[model samples]
Structures are given as C-alpha cells and as structure tokens.
Target: MTIKSNTRPVASAARDFLLTDSDFSRVRALIYQRAGIALGEQKREMVYSRLSRRLRELGMSDFTSYLAQLEAQHDSAEWQSFTNALTTNLTAFFREAHHFPLLAEHVKTCAQPVTIWCSAASTGEEPYSIAMTLIEALGNRAGNASVIATDIDTQVLEKAATGIYTMEQVSKLPQERLKRFFLKGSGARAGQVRIRPEVAAMVKFGQLNLLAPQWGLKEPFDAIFCRNVMIYFDKPTQNRILQRFEPLMKPHGLLFAGHSENFSYASQPFRLRGQTVYELDAKRGKGVA
Candidate 1:
C-alpha cells in the first residue's frame, strides 16, 4: 500500500499585520492624490515599513484599518504624519557648491532688491547655504537680501525653521564661515550647532504643497532654487509645474534644478544657463534647443 502524500502546505501570513495587495493599492492612490508622490509597485514594502510605525502608534492592527482613518478625513493630523513618513529629506550644506558662486555673481549684478526662493528647504541646509553665500557675496549688505524657503513636509519645515544642526552636519563649512555663521552648543546641547541669528533671519519658512492650485507667492523671484524635487513627479506633472514656474520668475530669473532632473522636455521659457540651471527666456527658447 503505497500511499502518496496528498497534504498541501498552508501559506503563512506576514508577521505583525497583513499588508494585502488591496491595502497597497489603496495607499498608493491616497498618497499620490494628497502629495503627488508616485509610489510604484516596488514601494509596496517601503510603504508597509514606513507606515507600519504609524499603525503601531495609533494602535492599529492592520493597513486596512489605518488607511480607513486616513481616508475618512483628508484634512486630519494623521494626514500630516503620513506625508512626513513618506517624504524624503536627504540634504546637506552646500550640496551643490557651484550654484552658490553663480548665485553670488547674479546677486552682484541685480539692480532691484534680490529675492531668491529655496523651493526644497530640507532640514534648513539648502536655505542656510544660500544665506551664507549671500553674506559672503554682499558682506553686511546681505542682511537685506530676501530668501523664501518652502517645503511640503511640515515636520521638515519645523526643523528648518529652527536652523539647528548636528556638528557633523556643518562640517563641510570652512572654520571661519562656521565661526561667523553658527554658534557652538554647550552643556546638554553639546555636539550640536545652531545657525547664528543674523543668518537665520535672512530666510523665512513655510509649508507649501506644490501640487495645490494656488502657490501663494506674492511676487516674482529673481532666482528660484527648486533643486532635486522634480525627480519625484511624472513627465506631465513636471511639465505643468515648470509652466507654472515660468510666469513666476522675473525676465532673467534663474531656476536651479536637482542634479538628476532634465527640463528639455518641459521647460519652455527657460534656457540652459549652466549645469542644472536655467534662465528665463521670454520667447520660450523656441529656436534654441
């Protein structure tokens, strides 16, 4: 009696909470709608991992339950938590060093009051770098220069507004610049540094979701540092945002992009001025590629 084994192995569920396919799709759609972040299929695990902490914090047992709460009220505080969890904020002082020198040169020639916008103010680094550049370029006159820093993530905006950093964060800065622009922390705050009041005062911080219908910028800027942010959006989305930026800039305003982004397809009113930098062209660079 040769009895063949007909037993089927039972499938095991993932530990802690089950993140079903339905759950992932639901989450992907919601995040894209709220924040314009395109979460691909590969991000399923990342979404599960990042938002899992949120679930635990809210005593939620599964993604279904957690997402339900988020969907129920689009304007809830949980929405902020969800956005904060997903938004990537990897930045450092002088991430693009070359841009500052060009910026200093641009500021030197501006006839009107120079105004610049750091479109992605991640943890204060980029905006602070701009402030330092201006200070060096215009000396004490830099205090009068205007900088508006904005980010979609409220959590990062709060951190940026504080202008505080770890010692290692400012390590790239020259010793003289460090001593001039930042204060060394002591006692409980040792190993940390804070941007000096004067430098911090040069910029203002705000929460702005670029996907919104209205951007709330009152006047056109002389220079806009929208670095490294367009990589997250699809082509059409990128084109739409670029078109929106065109009218917002002065006749020859500069637009600085992230290293990985290319505006050849979307940029109409801007021409290549430097690597990842564009200058306003009223004729939309029609004849010039």
Candidate 2:
C-alpha cells in the first residue's frame, strides 16, 4: 500500500500525523457521501493540513484513529466538523457582478413575492449582495423579498449570519453604496462594518448539505445561486443536484453558477441564460409550458 504524499516518507518528525492513501480515500468518500464534495487526489496534502487541527483538537495522533472513532461513534456532529474542514469556501461580495442586474430586474418585475436561495452562502457576501440588489430595485418593498442563504459548513454560516466584515474586506464596494447598506462600527468595534438591520433582515441562514436526501424548503425560488461550489462535485452529483433544483425553481427562475463550472453537462434541466447563469428548461420538471 502506498502512503499519500502528504503523509508519506515520514518527511519530518515534526509532522504530528500521517494521512495514508487509505485515509485519504476513506475521508474523501465520506465527504462525498455527506456533502457531495469530490476532492481529487491533488487535494490530499491540502486536506491533511486542513483536518490535522481537527485531529489535534480531538487528541488523536493519526488519521486512522480519528476515522475509526468517527465510524464507531457514528458521530454526526463530528462528521460536520469533518465536512467543514474539507469544504473550500472562496467567495466575495458581488463576486460576479453581472448576475445581479438580471436578478434585480427579475425582482422588480416579480408580482409574486421573490425568493432567492444562496446555496453556498460562504461568509454571507453573496446573499447580502443579492439583498442590496433587491433593496435598490424594490426599495421599501425589498422587505417582501426572501433570501435563504445556506451552506454545509456551519462555521461559515455563523459568520455569514453575523453580517459583520472588516473595512478592508469590503473596501471594494463603492463608498456611497457601502454607507447606504452598512453600519460602520465605532470605538471598540472600529474598522468593521455590520450589514444594516434592513439588509441583514433580508437573509435567513441555515446549514444545508446539498447532497442530503430531503430539502425542506417549502417555496420554489425565483433565482438560485449555487455557484463556485459545484466545481468540487463530480459530474453525476452535479447533474443530480441540478435535477433536484428543477422542481424547486420557478419556470424562468435563473440559476447562477460559478465561473469555473459549466452547466452544459447538466443542460437537460437548465438552459444557459448568460455567462455562468442558467434558467430552468420550461419543458422540464414543473416549469411552465
């Protein structure tokens, strides 16, 4: 059996843990089963580094013991930590600015209450961006819009719900826009800004594993942002999730994808709307004919 590069050759005595090939394969499989994240072989080293601290916090010396304990305990909470550890979260406010314009247009025209789901909310920027766009379009009526921001990583969701960010973190936002939607901290909390109550009120955060069998959301969304996170999933998983999303979307509801993912592979259920944005096929699922 070959030891994985990240844990093999006993590279240094300073290394506290060993992540064997077996360990890598088992952990990756578990993550896929639990969260639909398909980490490739190249990620072995990265996973080792990310989860090593988890092992340390558990007082375990190696991956084998930690994994066995997980299996023996059927530790669902522990599994969440495992999922959070391996998931990659890279997001920004208005990360893909173009999508928001059409989204805003949709919200403005929507007679029915608008609902948007930020499927991989990651630290809250995207959902807040969605909220800001809705606010601009609907003004006081923005209260009628719904934004459900979710992620499998509860850690990030907690931070996302807080809606607080460093000035430097949000400096890219235009100054006037920033002042309009955010509350600048003072004194003890200087250098940070919190999403104003009205904007923060627009979003509701939850921990959702996309691969989970049942999605409890009652209402179909007008636009769904399941962006850059899909690149971590295999094609079949991606397609399955897209299919599941079909029934959960309005006929012309748009699906925003990440820059790195192309939904053509899952085109049966979604048709390209714009760059990395898709709309549910009218003929598929419950879409209007």
Candidate 3:
C-alpha cells in the first residue's frame, strides 16, 4: 500500500513596484495635464510612495495595471486619491511674513472695497493670513473686505472650509492675531483651534484648478496671492497659468508669487513691480461674464 501524499503551494512576497520609464512618463503627463505639476527624476520615490497607495487602495497589485485603469476609467476614485495624496500642503499662519506688510500697504492705497484672491491656498492659512492682514489694516473698516480662496485639492479645501487647525499648525501666528481670531480647544478638543466666524466669514474656500478652462470668478480681484505654487510646474505650464491670471486681475492690481518663482517667460501684460510681485498693465477685462 502507498502512503497518501499531501502538498501545499508556497506564497510569494508582495511585489515591489519599480516604476519603469514609460510608467514615469505616463504619470508625469497625467499629473501635468490635470494639476499642472511636473515631476523630475528626483521625485521617483515620491511618485512610487504616493501612487502606490492608490494602487493598494484600488486593489491593484501593480503600477502598470493601476495606470491602465487611471487612463480607461472616466471616474476613478484612485485618480482622485492620487491627486489628494500627491499635493504638497506646506503652509502655516503668517507664512513668508513679508507679504502681510505689502498687503497692508496695498489695502491702504485702495479707497474702494478690497477683493483678494488667495490662489493655491493650502489648508486655508494663506487666505486666513490675508484676512488677518486686512483686519489689521482696515481695523474698524475690516467689513469692507473679502478673500476668495481657491485650490485644486478638494480634500484640503474641505479641511480649510472647516477652519480648524492643530496647535502646532497655528504656532506661527502672532500672539495678538491668535487671541483675536481663533478659539483654543478644550479637554476633548485639545491641540486644536477654531477660527472665529468673523474671520472665517471673510474667507470663501472652494475647489479651483488653475488649469481649468475658466476661473469662474465674478469679480476681478484687487490683489492675487499665488505664492509657492508655480515651483511644481514646468516653464510652459507656468507661463500658461500666469497668462490666465493676468486678465482676471484689476489693472494695477498686485500679483504675488513664491519667492523662488518668477514670471520671466510671461507676456508683456504683467510688469515686474517688486521682489515677488507683478503689476497688471493689460486693458481691464470683464469678470466671469
């Protein structure tokens, strides 16, 4: 008689996703077209770590298959998650401190109501900073201002709209502004603060892609804060985005960008007026009509 035989198959370890050149190119193109960001070879690990999460979330075991789904599926949650995961949200209250004084000066020069656009407002700090600046500038006159804050990242926008931030996040805020505009958390709410309604009301947060066909603004702004955003874009994308912003600014309106960003290739519509600011010289155009 022969003894019965028992056999079991061995399982393999999880596959490591090594991005191929084509995979890199595909993801770069997709992110560029949708979010206006350019990834250099240096960001290989960033692409892998960020995009790998999307693959895992969608139950895709490989980057190749995940990318195929990203291309074919018109409404894929993976694509949305990829965008949310990849965006850089480096921000804090009173960031790049110099900008506040400039904003105060601009507000002082204007006799009319002020409309400020905080483009690329990550998690709401920049727009909130603008509001605080206006509050300091306008004082009792603060009611005459509003900030239109927009960003392409919906996840960040939602967090921004809530106007809640961790204590570490608000640590950079000036003491007076912190006391005046924010409410510190209690027991269960430790390590958090909520923006006071008056300050929060002054800002309107929404989702806006700088690459969109139209900006959908009903009024041209007196000042546009697009700081620290263009660094991720290539030169051509940067030029195109700057061109779109030009017409939306009021004539002589100030355009602020990242300290590292410059409009060297931009059209003659804007003239360099300061270290990181541009002045709109083009003929004024109607807003959102």
Highest lDDT: give the candidate number.
2
lDDT: which is higher, 2 or 3?
A: 2
| Residue-level lDDT tens digits of model 3 in 1-289 | 9543222111133335656667777788888877888878778678877887777766777777777878998687666677777788888887778778988998888756789999988899889989988998988788979999999888999999999989988887778878999999999899999999999999998888888887788777888999999999888888887778766777678888888988866664778777888877746533332
Q: What local distance difference test score does each model get?
A: 0.83, 0.85, 0.81
Model 1 residue pairs with clashes: 228-258
Model 2 residue 250 lDDT? 81
Question: Tell me, what's the RMSD of every candidate?
Answer: 6.3, 2.5, 8.3
User: 195, model 3: CA deviation in Å?
Assistant: 1.0
Q: Which stretches of candidate 2 lie over 4 Å from their true place?
A: 1-14, 285-289
- In order of listing, the candidates' clash counts read 1, 0, 0
- lDDT computed for candidate 2: 0.85
Find the number of clashing residue pairs for candidate 2. 0
Mark the regions of model 3 whose C-alpha exceeds 4 Å error after superposition.
Answer: 1-15, 282-289
Alpha-carbon deviation at 157 in model 1, angstroms:
1.2
- lDDT value for candidate 3? 0.81
Q: Estimate the TM-score of every prediction.
A: 0.91, 0.94, 0.89
- Greater-TM-score candidate between 1 and 2: 2
